[model samples]
Target: MSEGNKNTNTEPWGGFDDNLIQRGGSAVIDMENMDDTSGSSFEDVGEMHQRMKDEEEVTAEAAATEEEGGEDGEFLGMKGIKGQLGRQVADEVWRAGKRQASKAFNLYANIDILRPYFDVEPIQVRNRLIESLIPVRMINFPQKVAGELYGPMMLVFTLVAILLHGMKTSGTVIREGTLMGTAIGTCFGYWLGVSSFIYFLAYLCNAQITMLQMLSLLGYGLFSHCVVLFVTYSVHFHSLFYLLWLVFGGLSTLRMVAVLISRTVGQTPRLILCGTLAALHMLFLLYLHFAYHKIVEGILDTLEGPNVPPIQRVARDLPNAITVLNATGKALAAGADAILTQ
Candidate 1:
């Protein structure tokens, strides 16, 4: 091999070594240049990391906001359901109350059929009461008027209540329920029996009257009895009580006669009917008076007994106490006069 050839081969290897050194040197110089810009590059990386964290926080807040909105919606939905239930209950209660009120009203008045009777004006009631008190037939009285049981029912109840109150005040030893029942039954029985009897008689005579009308007439006639009872119980005078009884009884008899005569055709029949009715009415009046007198006498006997009530005893002794005080005062005055004369 020539010397040049050997040199060439060696130079090829050396060039390869030089190429590696140049590559290493260039790598070192690039590293030095990278160090000069290291601070700026780090700052850029920190900015990117901060931006990523900010995005993550935003995402979490949005998710939390969505969850709160969903909870609020659920709460509103429950409130709406509760409000609907409350309204439904209120409607049911209002409807039930209306139904109960309707039933009670129907039971009492029967307003559909008895509207006219129930609709009586206040002035009409006053006039009717006044007319019932008078003995004569009223000129403007409604003839063949439809009968109403409400007025008679109220009057009977009122009379019974008054009697019960009076009995209680007199300290009667009767059971309240038994006395009330007996009184109501007796009153109704007597009224119905007498009215039925009169109705049968009128029907036989072919009178143009109804049982209801007859009952209404007789029922109104009981007003005198109520008045007599009140006056007799309130006034302590026996004579006044008897006088009023006679007057009211006579007036009631005359009124019945006047009304009954108009219903009959023949003179003799009318007179007979009136006489019978008057006799029956007078007997009833006598029975009432005797019963009332018996009650009063019984109460008086109770008051006069050894076990007199405290209220009665106080009333009875008040006048005696006053007389004693007056006597004491007079004796004191006489003593003072004697002292002055000395």
Candidate 2:
């Protein structure tokens, strides 16, 4: 019996000699330590080590998949891990949105223009754009955007106004290419006058002013001209339209003088000197009117239509208007007579 017990002690726990199994000289089994093949355990340690190694490999693969943000996280019940990763993705999306908003802001520069060109608010911009064409005290007004932006924009609008007026006067799509040339010439001529005035201000008054500010003011002054042009287009059929437009042009000229007086304040004989430059504005308007009318007449003559003198053309159309009025009156009178007979 003693010899049998000694043999049993030399072997593993095979239903006998239970001295706590003596795994690595430890009395207790650490199941957590089963992953380490260096340690020993009960129930076929070699086989358990092989199984643990396989389980560790599978755990490592699942961990790698989670780190890589693959589709395997849901299968492995690693939804909590994805929550941490979602923040990085959201940050990227937010940055992209900011880029798009910035681009959109640049494309629509006039969205905050607060008022239309012909608006009559109780108080205009503090720069006193309403009181004068361009207030010298623009340095006081706080703008959401740059002052430089408003100047070039005004010029662009002036160009558009010229194009519209030319199209209306020509009244033919066939002459669009020629009309475009005329429009460009008209704008160029107006700017040439403005440039000449700017040079005069420099020579006569020695006004310490920037050309950019003068350009900005001149462009703003052109807005009144644009409005007056629109009125002309609206009422051109009326004989007195030209006379009425000239009245508005005179008022626009005064506002331009105000713009110049504000700029050339320190110079002696300021009003007279400014007037010399300001007179150019009136001449510019007159030149535009005469040149525009002549161009329109020339275009009408060149066009493939009834070749007649402008006087003849109007004399011809005027009779038709009178004839239509007479016909309509006769038709109404006949209808009334028929009703009376009934």
Candidate 3:
């Protein structure tokens, strides 16, 4: 018999043939180069399978290590996506910071409101504060610029409220904490109420607006009201002035959401949102004005005896029935009399 035929007949089906294995596989593997620990006994098919599994695991780990270093990745004709994605994120942040700083100082000059501006630069903060007073910046940059401006800007308006409050209680003897607390509370509470309503509407529309942003812009709205108050301190603000600023504040808030979700929110939903926010703003302002007397009186009554009158409370509560007619009449007269006597 021929050698090949003799071997084929003599060898059993399960017997090892390194030549058969080498020929059947798609790739060549040098078994001689395999480590000594991997059993060299190829006679047993089960032992050969275990050795082959160990080699596969070792090769896979080595490939993975090289892939992490980007060598194997390139060898497979693929670029490192992780590095590219990281660079994209870093570039976006850098550009956003620059854009925020630029727009903060030059709002009218720039018309874009696509970017959400946060992380205001120190030098840009003062400029941003001034820009926020203008309707465009207040509405457009509520998230990035106006949000940070809330703190110091509200502090200024709160002080104005405090001063007007002191003017109201010229003759009254009350706890300083009570007076300060009322002014601070009224100032902050007003923002809280207004922002809460706006936040609810924005969330309903699936907008990306946040409570902090809403509060900050509401604080800016407070600045407008406080300016009106400061200008009319002697006579108190007219209802028309209140109405105008109310319209102003509401439109600004609605515009802010419009800018944020211009593509997502529909016109019908936008109108509904506007109507809801307008109602909220009107009610919030009405509550502040009409309820001021009762609120102050209650605080005074809470702090003192029930006998304490609202006029004898802080100046913030001097408005009788929330009307501008008799509102601040006593406080204004007191100021005039004190000036005339001096």
Candidate 4:
């Protein structure tokens, strides 16, 4: 056997490798490197195993060090610092936790005490107020234009509405002056149609709306019409005026849609409404045309009189003038097209 193997098989205490050791010197240690006062010894294998176990315990201690130990349980606190610094951090964490718990307990106690007297309905109202203030969606560029125009347009409408109210309340009509009423109604309708068309155009471009926005337009028109009718005796207080304006504007938009959706499979609800309104308006206008023919003829006779004001006569003749203009324009367009084709 070699010297190294001989050392492995024998002990300094006169035992073979298989012999059980006495507690005194069974632990074989490297005395030069070891603490000499403790009477400790180590066998080569035993020393290695003990060193491994010590190392494992130190690793475990380091892992556990992150959590601060308390009587109740382990708390997630500064376990990173060493010695006194770690203890200080642990103390601060414990204090903060206690403070937070006490505050929470107090809050709960107060809520419980007030629960019986609390009115939930008011809470709902407050919530609704907050929700209303929180903007649902932003208004785009076109909607901004609509908002800017809405104010002045509304003022005009309010004046008209006031005039209408006055006429309805007065319940008086001049003789052979019924045509004047028809003319006024028609003009009001035309103005309303222009305003509505512009408003709707803006809304369409923006592709957004709110109930408030709709109401703003309606209110303005109502107020404007009221002012116009109440301040002047101009037999123009016709509700149909505003109705036709809304109807015609809607029809114009519908016509535009029809052009775009010619090949599409379905009609929108707006298209249906527009079609219905246009049909009804046309029928109603036809009925009025026949009904007021005699009154209109009488008004035309007055227009022939030299004493009649040019403005009054112009107002009387305007409807027929518009019809002529429309026909003339269409004919001119057709003529131009024919000349081009040739």
Against the unseen true structure, what C-alpha lDDT does each candidate score?
0.55, 0.48, 0.47, 0.38
Q: Write the per-residue lDDT of candidate 1 for residues 94-165, one digit (tens) a residue.
A: 568769998998778766775654566667655655555565664244344336566566667766765665
lDDT of 4 by residue, 1-342 (tens): 223222432323212211211112223532321333223555466544643444344335534552345322212222212222333344456558769999999998888664533334545433432332222233222222122223434444444444334333333234455634644664356445534553464355442434334333332233323322333333333454445434543443333233223322234633543344345334433333233333333344444545444444344343444344334333334334444675
Q: Worst lDDT window (10 residues) for model 1?
A: 13-22
What C-alpha lDDT, on a 0 to 100 scale, does residue 298 get in candidate 1?
46
Which candidate gets the maximum TM-score versus the true structure? 1
Query: Model 3, stretches more than 4 Å misplaced?
Result: 1-130, 136-146, 149-177, 236-264, 282-342
Clashes of 1: 0
Model 1, residue 325: C-alpha shift (Å) = 38
Residue 33's lDDT within candidate 4 is 18
Which stretches of candidate 2 lie above 4 Å from their native place?
1-129, 133-152, 171-177, 196-200, 237-247, 265-272, 294-342
Better of 1 and 2 by TM-score: 1
Ranking by lDDT: 1, 2, 3, 4
lDDT of 1: 0.55
Pull out the clashing pairs in model 3.
117-144, 168-315
TM-score of predicted structure 4: 0.21
